[model samples]
Target: MKKLALNYVDTFKGLSKEVWWLALITLINRAGTMVIPFLSIYLNKNLGFTKEQVGTVMVCFGLGSLVGSWLGGILTDKIGYYKVMVGSLVLTGILFFGLQFLETYTQFCLGIFIVMTVGDIFRPAVFTALNAYSKEENKTRSLTLIRLAINLGFSVGPAVGGTIIVAFSYTGLFWVDAITCIVAGILLLKVLHPKKAKVLDTHENKKGKSVLTDIPYLMFFGCMVMFSFIFVQLMSTLPLFYEEYYHLPENVIGFILMTNGALIFIFEMPLVKYFENKKIQHLNSVIIGVLLTALGFAVLLYTASMYASILIGMVLLTFGEMVGFPFSNAFAVKRAKRGNFGAYMGLYSMAFSIAHIGGHKFGLESIKAYGFLQTWQFMAIIGAITVVFLFFLKRIIQKEK
Candidate 1:
């Protein structure tokens, strides 16, 4: 038992101070995302916006995310991850704090856009830095640890936000999130001060290849978009489904999401390690994950009375997410050009932005037409379709390898 414990400690010892600091900052940064899980609720209940209006307003957030991903890539390459992350976090924190004072719908929409743009700018840069800092052999574990931190933060954020909403107001959640972001930004500024490496510029010149022309990287990016398109439904439509169809309370819905994050925190690392050495293809992992997620959605369609059944479905979906998420980052890092990590991570972030936008638009329309259960069924079918696309993506990635 002691040997086992010592070995575990040694495994963590391989991580550098920079990685640890970055992970801590990421946890603090993401802990402030309390408002996101309840944004639709806030719009409907607190701000008196219709569901349709909320969906339309969300489009601005997606647009900002898309722009931020592209800009982060270019700027990270030029200025370094440290500066980009710090600046983005500080700017975004200010916007989030300002959201508490907004009254008009237009102002709320603009605030969301500004917050998303600045928040997303640090995302790709931070992930790129993590990849750069990790040893090749420990890279997957490092990424897994980061995911675990994110899930841990998310678990706390929503539960706390739910309580705060009940106790005070949605504005309280916004203020908390803003303060967390500011603290995270300050910590990151102190810890990450490395000079910009010129290796990517040299590689681009030597290979005479445009950064955007990497075919495998593009395929991976496309895969991220497809998966995120299916997954974003959980946040956008799933809560509404619970409220309208299941007749569940807001706090109950919040608890369910907390469960999802908690499961990821507990199981993601072990699952990633299990698949790390296996010859199972990256595309295969994606297919399996998406299929499980889709099946979970399908199962939810059959359960009308039992909340336990809904919890079972959540288990399946969370397991699927665990399998899919870490591997996607690993695959992207593997396929990325040496020293151009930021650009590749940015492309991945862009895929997620596109997916969220598409999912929100489709989910809102589908829920209106078919109702919640049938809409989830439709999403399940879309997830299965993504699995089919992965077969083609696998061949492309293998050829590049």
Candidate 2:
């Protein structure tokens, strides 16, 4: 047992120093993001906003993220990943600190939008840097580790954030989140110094050929937008479902979400590695994931009891999430041109932002019009159709290949 443990330690030691720093940065940044899971709660409870108004405000945050993703790619191409990430983190931290003073609904919405936009700008730069740094053989594992760190933060951050909110106020939560972002920014700037490469100078090269010209990449992003539209329901609609139907307490909801995060942290890496070598057609993984996620929603719709059924549904959702996310990233990376990796990643992140806005706007209104179960049933149908569309799309891309 001791020898086995030693071997594991040695294996970790063999990884690139950059991977370790990336994972640490991911964890810290994600810890700061804990505020998101409870943002709806804070707005409704503390700020006295209606559900529709909250949804509108959240869309502003999504809009900021959409713009940030594009700007991050451009900046990364010009100044390199490390500088973009450092700048993003520092600005985000300042914005987050400023959030404590926001009392009015408009102020809250605007503050969150600015903070999310500046903070999320680091995503594409960071992902591109990790992809560039990792060996082909270790790329999946490295990405998985980064994701695990994110989930680890997800697990801890919500539970802690929820506890703080319960004990103190939303202001305290904002302060903690802001401090963590600043600390993470400092650590990243000190540890990871990504040198600018001439290869990534998009301006000096072809002025006509932009990153958006890549069709397969655009299709992939389109698929992700659809996927996020379905997935974001978990955040926007599911809590309302639990509250209305089961009368589940907020703390219980937090625990359930923490369970999802814990499961992802435990299983995401191993599953990614296991599927790494399979030539299973990237779209197939996506299709399967979508189908599973749809099934999770169906289960939730039928769930009469609270704990056990919800847990089962969550497991399925997490499993689907694990399969879907990394493959989407890998597919994007595979299709991206060498110098424009950050741009591709940025485009990819924009899909999620778009989906978040679409989901919140659509999901809430749909539930109001159709009723929760019927609305979810419609979502499941949409998810299945999306998978079918992607399957055909994959065939076309494969034929081109």
Task: Give per-candidate clash totals.
Answer: 0, 0
lDDT of 2 by residue, 1-401 (tens): 89855644443443467887889988988987778889888888888899888887888888889989988887877887888888898888778878878889888878888887898789898877777667656665666778788878876788799888888778788788888888898988777755422122222224424667767667777888888898988876888887887898888887887777777765676566567657665577778788888888878776667676788888888898988887777777666653376787789889988998788778888889988889888888878877887887888788887
Overall lDDT per candidate, in order of appearance = 0.78, 0.78
Q: How would you encode candidate 1's per-residue C-alpha lDDT over 1-401 as one tens digit per residue?
A: 89866654554656666677778888888878889878878888888999878877788879889888878887877787778989988887888888878777898888788778878988788877776677676677787788877877877787788998888788788888888888888877666666422122222323324447876667667767878887888776887888887799988998897788778765676677677657566668777888888888887877755686689888988988988877787777666654366777788779888987788788878889888878887878888887877888787766866
Model 1 TM-score on a 0 to 1 scale: 0.86
- Which candidate has the highest TM-score of all? 2
Q: Please give the distance, in angstroms, between residue 11's alpha carbon in candidate 1 and its true position after superposition.
A: 6.7
Error of 2 at 146 (Å): 1.9
